[model samples]
Target: MSAVPNQAGSWSTLETPLSEPIMETLGLLGFDAMTPVQAGAIPLFMKNKDVVVEAVTGSGKTLAFVIPIIEKLTRREDPLKKHEIGALIITPTRELAQQIHSVFSTFIDDHPKKDQLTLGLFIGGTTTLAQDITTFNQSCPRILIGTPGRLEELLTRSQKIVNTKELEVLVMDEADRLLDMGFSQQLSRIIAQLPKQRRTGLFSATMTDAISELVRAGLRNPVRIVVKVEDLTSKGSVQRTPASLDINYIVCDPEQKLIQLVRLLQAELNDMEGARKFIVYFATCACVDYFYKLLKQIGDLKPFSLHSLHGQMDTKRRTATYTNFTQLPPAVPAVLLCTDVASRGLDIPDVDYVIQIDPPQDPKAFTHRCGRAARAGRKGKATVFLIRGREETYIEFLKLRKIPLERGYYRLEDGSVCDNVLKNDDAEDEKITTSEVEDASVAPFIATLRAIVKKDRDMHDRGMKAFVSWARAYSKHEASFIFRLKDVDLGRVATGYGLLKVQKCPN
Candidate 1:
């Protein structure tokens, strides 16, 4: 049912069974020891047994699946036959598919048969179908890495472009994200096209009902390996993201959340030196856009460059942003404001911090989001900003699930939250009253503010000053547009932000 990690074995253990080429490549790649997931899953994978692994992001799950597939391909007597796709690895996002492909390419580069056993990447928007077809026709790559939609599109466009019958291994990376992104239909269609008699490996950051159901249907007698915190809590244990990760949360009014987030970034840059990478997760694209704009204009954030990513951005821009952020030089502060799109499987190096503006709907997502940091045994910190009253339930859920979390605070020069907000005369003075709304002269402006507020269900009155400040900068109308809004309309927007009846009204 499950496999325990074999502590005694390392990559060297495979030296006797695997050809010298694979061993030499592993050595060159500087992979000496086996991650627990690798130790547990690789043995089953090499035995031609199907595997379903529940491991966090950046846990070396990519290589666990890649190495065995490469070894199988290399052991084959004949070179990759015409149009044969020896191994197919399907991921949910183009970035992840590209990342995995890069890793595969590096390993393949060191292989003796690098030219014969090639790797191909197929993702939408990155290349034209005709171009992909030509490349496939010329080399007929033995290893194929791609997202579901692009792979499905290619299959429908060309009948024999991918010889599924010749595929020896089928891998689904981030299987949970695939299901969450509503790719189940596309995944089902792709699976139907794949050969039934093949080794299938499904890997995900968490085990969910959908993943379990897919495992039951897609994999036969799969060896299951689920890595838990307890598995890795012991020093020297190999499992999941390192226990060195620091988890914390800061409770604040919904409106001040973004301001506080900016404060955290300011603190990081002020206190630390050298290259630092930070990922801040928002609940929606609207939140990400607003925060990106706010961060660009506010505070002492000018020194650090900012990048925004969401589902709406075109592939080229998203790729460019990812490249720029990941490759930043030392002493440069790089920050990525994104939705869950970046949370799943992209392995960005040297990420020093991860901040969640709001608690994720699923507790499991918190683990993966934080897993982006503390990678490869490096120390990192993860913080979640919670609205004082609303987030207690989510925090409780996290605690009940046994996810580690610490209470956090901002040590600003002015004062702490307790001294500033809880015990200050200015607290009531800063509260916005609902009756203070100035009706907008134009319907379009009112409508625009309503649309923006509707997208964010977590906004509150405490944040109105910040919103107005952002609105004034955003609309180019200065203070006139904000004053023009009817009190009722602004109140409606505040309600959308999760403002309560008893709270202070907008000023």
Candidate 2:
């Protein structure tokens, strides 16, 4: 029943000497044998070979590379000697950087071994470069982990990393994210600053084209490890976010989505679980700021409003927002209104629910957003609301996975489970998708867009172009296209064509 995979996606024999504390933490966290992802990726790291790990979320990826890093700390002479930055870890967001650092720190603290190594967290918004430079000057910290921008800046501006040549191993935690943030160019630049002899490690939930190019650019001939597909985490049947969840979808007018969001927050205030940590996912920075200001004005909700943590926020403010959310108490309900930027790397352990104020970019991103709720074996909930007219997407989502379409308690106010949801039942007969096919899951959505464009459509037959544009844009901003009737209308036929179908989600 454990979510951890053994090897890539299979099971693993627990033979490696992962710091004693990590072993204890695994047991504490309810892990037995290594998960498939961990099993496959660990050996590559152990041998100091560059690695690219592709597995689903929650597959015990943190330890896959951390063990090798720790083992190297022991293999090297004078373990605490900070001659140079021995290890460098880059993450997309401050929250994720802190989370990876914390997990490593926790392992080190608990491990009966590894008492001599000194690890330093070089992050922006709080720890100044001067302080890190001084620490490096003192020459005590062995490992350096930080956000990409800050670390890249430190290497260029400070002589500490360059003088010591301590950048021995580089680990990119959210490899796909780093690629998505358009850091491919930045990563190439940063890697150039370091010696080319170091080992590289990459971990991601998905292997995208940009990420594949990143591996080619960053890693040498590397060990390609794949896990069992069954072990991979995937989309939930009814809830986009599974793991630990009880989701409820509400229906409302497209224009009233924001109103629906506020109403959902109101519902959480009275949940008997009394959990306080929450993240409201939006599709755009404009929505984030708009909701932030509107949420800030609400005085009686007993919730703390967190500002925009998107690309627009300065590193300093972004770091601070991350701090307040993770470190602050739940005296009042803490609501972080954020764009998809915070969805991947950040970890807020106590979060009981993730209120997707807006729909997800696609099924893949939707599941990832819901994943923010449940972490480290904890249960969580995700709710996505669509107005009645737009509800047929329910069947479409479930059909893509071929999982049971059981209708849960997410009935409409009128007590109907399949009410008004559009699904294509005949879509499967086309041989592209089975009859059980539902709305486009994450991958299918992207593939659908690509497929539409692949076919040369009539220049005047906007049927394909409009649908493709709508599908692509919908993957970015669902609400943005609510009014683009041309694309929505076209997509109903061209995007999925015969492959598209509408159906209700099973309970």
Candidate 3:
């Protein structure tokens, strides 16, 4: 079924000026009308001026920039040449590149009368170098999207396939993140290889002084478009103030944090009516991995699965995981367990929740993570899970922006946990006293062997039935229960799947 626009009744008469294919794609994607960013930036970008667009995440930033570029490129009178990277979109992370690339693919797939043009994506988290390089060298994709380092490496090495001089448009998506991750020098190197006359555009959810200087240096007297004025705060409105997004901060201690998260997800899932997919973020892969497995094993509710996108997995697996999740909406609602690296301007819609399983190392990341949901006039929720010892930095971070956090939680005085207290509505004793450190700093990792059963409820007759078998496989590592991607056999899974001749792994 084609996606229907919310305002289809009068959209055709407004001289909206979208190409017939784009209009159709819009209708197919259910984009009812032009967003504020799209409304302002599209026309300016269609004029081919260098553009710097600053808007919050989930504000339809994708279409704001994408429609104009697509409109300009596909409608061009000249035929695109082979082996030339005509349009380049540079992103900060591999996950984002893959995510945006998937979006473009979907949009183009549904677009009618799309020109027969080669498109290439250069992202990490996948180990398909030969396939990617072949596409790069031979296809000369009209639109080239990639992360900074990989794209740069390919350009410097692939003399046989690339013609940077032929590039007509350059886009730096998430310029702040690219710079934050120390991509400034890499960006500069990549820029030097492109034609100076090419049109340049930079898009970000927020702006810092560093990003401003980047725009001035990269763009030619660029047109600046800030859609934040339409942003709302203290409310869920998507169109007007430092004030469209309502900021909700929940303070809890480490003790009851997991329970709080489970409650949060259940509420979000139930309330959203399963419309939005959630991105549950953690500080480290281990945190994500441990929680994901524990939930799967302990909870009898559903066949919940977890995916880790850290460096532990090779590039190919990581790319495949991201591709699978963002390919299209899930068959049913699902949760994405990821790190901060996956948070940025990947336009996933209908997301109502952004759950920070761990507090972000930096404050700016808070905005980016929250941007996942509550998009385009849609009411979304951003929940941060905080513990006691980390209060000083976390509180100071919020204070920097004048946002007040509310303290609340289920409870903290459980027998097992005492390290991090829970968020308490009772503030008389809000600050966790040092005497509560019984469970240890990393209490969450070492689940009580018996409670693991109590938490999941299905270990014996149902979920993760292979835990004991798999756990037996990793006796050397002394992991209580063993595991594998899926099905490596109990003993072999315990010993680490196939140094000899393994059959299967832990389920």
Candidate 4:
């Protein structure tokens, strides 16, 4: 379905101003209406103006900058001649770089003259320097997406092969993160190598002092665009978070947080009409790991499987867990415990609920966590858990940030699900016990485990050893219980199905 805007300042509304080819590509991408950030920034960009956009994740910020770059790069005077690197997109992480490159590749794939254009991804941890140099020498892509460190290295080592003198556009995605990660000097060095006269864009979830400095030095008379949360509350507005999402908060005692989370998960898991897929956020990896273990030990919560994403885990384990949780069916309950790393630029579909165990350090982080759900206009729920005493502080912060949050009630120790919690709710001791908790059927749980291994097989041609390794690493159950079967030997069945080999597995 081609997007036809109903009013002015919409994507379909901008159709006449954009070239036919770009509009055709957008139609294929299913982008009918323009996101607020996109509508606010794209017109200025089309006129060769610099822009600094501060929009939360999943607010179409990517396309807000990407479309303009595409338009500028494709409008070259001589397409028949060897294409030069027209646009340079600098990202903070390898995953983000790959994601941005994938977005660019999608449009390029649909272009009429795709053979004349190329998109390159330069990031560390996957390829060697020699391989990168060879690719650069053979095909200096017309559009380049890469991390700051690797891009700087390539510019210094392969100076002759990689040219930026004619670079028409430059973009810094997640500029705040880059600055927070101490990439100021490296970003500066890379910028020093770029052409002085070019349209620039700086996009991030937040605007800190460091980001402001970057904007001052980087963009020229840039137009600043901020997509506020209150905009979503406006009637008939097409800006900010989708109206389908239910944004709420829950206040509890610090000591009772874990029990409160358990109760919420129990209610959601047992309720006939509740979301099955959930993403729970925490302040630290230790908290995530601790809570993941606690949930695994709770028999009542057995219906819901758990996955994790944090900086401490090995890259292989982290990637595997991400793939599993993302692929798991919504009917089979799954919860992904993660930190800020999973909050940005990572799109996980069908997320029914997003729970923040603690109030996020800032409003931008809260918005990104909520963005994990209610995507693509789908209805979802987001809840924040605040300690009793700090409720007022967080509430004040939200008010100052102009974030719209509704109070939500949850089942408390008093056996009543209510919205109000006193500042010192834990004055009396109440221990939560699971002794009487009933067991949910294991059919769905077992099937979810098998489904993960099956998806891994579909993605890679690995043998049984790999499956066992992943299962062992991912599941908290003892190896025997996780792989046990009533009729057929689980090992034999797996081997017969090409998911396992006859080698002795690790304990």
| Strongest candidate by lDDT | 1
Once fitted onto the true fold, the runs of candidate 2 whose alpha carbons sit more than 4 angstroms away are 1-13, 21-35, 78-81, 109-116, 125-132, 157-168, 195-197, 227-249, 266-276, 296-300, 303-309, 314-317, 328-333, 360-364, 387-507
Per-residue lDDT tens digits for candidate 3, residues 17-89, read 7777777777877877776666666666767778888776766666666666676677767766666666888
After superposition on all CA atoms, what RMSD does each candidate show versus the true structure?
Answer: 9.0, 11.5, 10.5, 11.7
- Residue 483 local lDDT, model 4: 22
lDDT of 4 by residue, 255-354 (tens): 3455567678888777788889999987666556645654565566787888878877775677688779877977988899988778777768789899
Global Cα lDDT for candidate 2: 0.60
Lowest-scoring 10 consecutive residues by lDDT in candidate 4?
430-439
Model 2, 73-155: lDDT tens per residue?
Answer: 76676544445567778887777777788878866765655444567677777668788777666745667777788777777
**Candidate 1 ranges beyond 4 A from true positions:** 6-9, 231-242, 272-275, 414-507
- lDDT of each candidate versus the true structure: 0.71, 0.60, 0.60, 0.68
Superior by TM-score: candidate 2 or candidate 4:
4
Candidate 3: misplaced stretches above 4 Å?
A: 1-16, 110-113, 124-131, 229-247, 266-276, 300-306, 323-333, 389-396, 402-507
TM-score, prediction 1: 0.79
Model 3 has an lDDT value of 0.60
Worst 10 residues of 2 by lDDT: 431-440
Clashes of each: 16, 46, 32, 2
Provide TM-scores for the models.
Answer: 0.79, 0.69, 0.73, 0.74
Residue 453 local lDDT, model 4: 45
Better of 1 and 4 by TM-score: 1
